[model samples]
Target: MANIKEHLLNTLEELATEDLKMFQWHLTNNVEDDKHIPKSRLEKADRHDTVDNMVQKYGQIGAVEITLDILKKMNNNQLAEELRTKVKNN
Candidate 1:
C-alpha cells in the first residue's frame, strides 16, 4: 500500500496540467471542514485563478506537501479513498 506522500506524488504525476491545477484549487477551497484558503481570499473567482493563487501561496511542491498534510490530518477513510480513486481515474 502507498503512503500519503507516495500517493500525492503519484497522483500529481498522473494528472494533466489543468486537472492538477483544479486539484490544487480544490485543496485550497473545497473539502468540507477544512479550509486551506484564507477567509479573505475565499470569495468567488475563476478556478484557474485559484491555481495561480496556489502557485503564489504554496508553489508546486508546497501545494502538494500542504495538501498531503491536510489530507493526513483529516484522517477520513472515505475522503482518502475518494482522492485515491480520483487519482486513479484521472
Candidate 2:
C-alpha cells in the first residue's frame, strides 16, 4: 500500500462538485459544532475559493494532509476507490 499521505492526497480529488461544496461548508462552520452547512464556505468553494477553509474547519492536521495527498494523485479508478472507502468509513 502507499504511504498514508500519498494515498489520501491521491484520493481527495475524487470529491464531486457537490461533495466539495459540502466539505467546505462542513469545515468552515464546523459541522460538529454547527450541525448544518455554512453558507459562506459553500459559496466560497462554489466560487472556486481556497482550500484554506478546509484546514481551518478540519483542524485535525491529518485531514488536511490527507486531502492534499488525495488531490495530488487523482484518477478515475483511484477516485472511485477512494469514494467507496470514504462512504463506507462514514
Best by TM-score: 1
Q: Residue by residue across 10-40, what tens digits does model 2's lDDT show?
A: 4444567766654454454543554333566
- The C-alpha lDDT values of all candidates are 0.53, 0.46
Estimated TM-score per prediction? 0.38, 0.37
Give RMSD to native, each candidate. Answer: 8.9, 8.3
lDDT of each residue in 1-90, candidate 1, tens digit only: 654344455544555565555555566566544436664463454444554555566665565455555545544345445555744554
Candidate 1 deviant stretches above 4 angstroms: 1-37, 45-49, 76-90
TM-score of 2: 0.37
